[model samples]
Target: MAAVAILLLVWQGVSVAGLVPRYMLPAPVEVLQAFWKDRGALWNNSLITLQEAGLGLVCGVSLGFLFALVMDASPLLYRAFYPILVITQTIPTVAIAPLLVLWFGYEMTPKVILIVLVTFFPVTVGLLDGFRSVDRDAVGLLRSMGASKKQIFWYLKAPSALPQFFSGLRIAAAYSVVGAVISEWLGGFGGLGVYMTRVKSAFAFEKMFAVIFLISAVSLLLMALVNGLERLAMPYRKVKQEEREDSQ
Candidate 1:
């Protein structure tokens, strides 16, 4: 918070001192005023963007988890599909977004697909790494005790892999909103990106700044929500923290 304050002060100083044109980089207060002025439109567009992001995140996470599980269960499948996943990542979001918009029209479908594409890789890779990181001795012990594969996964693998899953989720959460906005840039009836395009065309830099800040705030909010979910899902982490504090 202190760092942000300092940065804001610097920005204010720069604006006041005329280091840059007001049209190019408006003062924070000006941006705030713009944000307040356009609150109604901003709010409506925000809801659209949020819905797209949320839908994409859920689908992306599910698909990634399923892929990770299948790959983890079969070494050959992992070897075959891992490269293909990597290749997918090489296709830039901006490059494919146009095609998606062209094919899907200016609907929400393309936007959601873009978000899913952007978010899927991190989750799949993170969970796969987590699954593979399980202790060999522990797996052997479980098997020696006549544990079923399902039992081993439930008792050992799932818990062990949760941290990695959440780590990936944190990244995906951030990507979800960004992907939505980027997709909106190409074609969308409504969204922050659409609003931004309108403001930019009119040379309303202050309003553009306002939407940019809102986009960032939305991304941070999503990431924080993911962090909250991680805490709830991994109560043992809290216990570990408490134990460490007690030790100290």
Candidate 2:
């Protein structure tokens, strides 16, 4: 918090000192004022973006998890799909967004697709890595105990993979909103990205600054949400009292 305060103080000092033109980089106060004034539109647009992101994230994570299962179950599947998945990311997101909008029209479909595209890779890779990282000895022990493949997966693999899954979720959470907004940038009726495009065209620097800050805040909030979900999902991952004492 102090660091943020100090940075803001330095920013205000720079603006007050006229080190840069206000039009180019508005003062934080100006941005704040603009944010407050535009709160209604921002709130409405934010809702649309948030919805797109939320839906996309669910779809992305689900698909990625399933893909991980398939790949982890078969080495041939992994060899074939892994390279293709990595290759998909080589195509720039900006390039893909326009095509998705063109194909899907200006509705929410394209925005959600963009989000899925942005989010899925991390999750798929993370879960796959997690599944593969399981100790071979543990699997052997489970097999010796006459555990079925399904039983082993349910009791061992999934649980062991959860930490990495959550880590991927954190990354996906950050990407989801940004992806939705960027999709909106190319074509959308309303969203933060649309608002930003209009503000930039009109040379509303203060408002642009305000929206940028809002976007960052939204991304951070999403990440915090993912972190909370991680705790809930991995409740057995308790911190030992001895570790706590050591830290203290």
Candidate 3:
């Protein structure tokens, strides 16, 4: 918090010093004022982006989880699909966004698809790595005890994968929101992206800064929510950390 305050102070000082033109770099105060003045419009647009992000996260995380499960179940599937997953990510999203817009039209589908593309890779990779890292000895023990594959997965692999899954989710949360906004940049009816475009076109730099800051705050909030979920999903982890702190 102190570091952020210092940074803001430096920004305000620089603007006041006229190091850059006011139009090019508005002061924090100007941005804040614009934020307050345009709060209604911003809120409405923000909800749309948030909805797009939420739905995208759901779809992306679901698909990624399913993909990881299939890959884990069969080494052949892993080998076949793993490369395709990696290759898909190599394509720049900016390039893909326009293509998706063209195919899906200027609706929410393309934006959702864009977010899913940005989000799924991390989750797939994380879950795959986690599943693979499971102890073969433990797996063998379960097999020797006449445990079915489903039982082994439920008791062993799924729990092991959760931490990594949550890690991926955190990354995906931020990416999901940003991806929606970027898709809106190409073409959309209303969203933070559309709002940003309008402000930029009208030379409303203060509002531009306002929207940028709002987007960042929203992203941070989403990440924080993920962290809370991680804590919930792994209560033992939190307890262990607390024990360590007490001992220290």
Clash totals, every prediction: 0, 0, 0
lDDT agreement of model 3 with the native: 0.95
| Models sorted by TM-score, best on top | 3, 1, 2
Model 2, 53-156: lDDT tens digits are: 99999999998988899999999999999989999889899999999988999999998888888899899988988998888899999999999999999988
Give one digit per residue, the lDDT tens place, for model 1 in 16-38: 99999999999998999999999
lDDT of each: 0.94, 0.92, 0.95
Score residue 127 of candidate 1 by CA lDDT.
Answer: 95
Please identify model 1 stretches exceeding 4 Å from their true place: 246-248
lDDT of 1: 0.94
Question: Which digits, one per residue and each the tens of the lDDT, describe model 3 over residues 1-248?
Answer: 99999999999999999999999999999999999999999999999999999999999999999999999889999999999999989989889998999999998999999999989989999999889889999999999999999999999999988889998999999999999999998889999999999999999999999999999999999999999999988999998999999999
Model 3 misplaced stretches (Cα beyond 4 Å): none
RMSD of each: 1.1, 1.3, 1.0
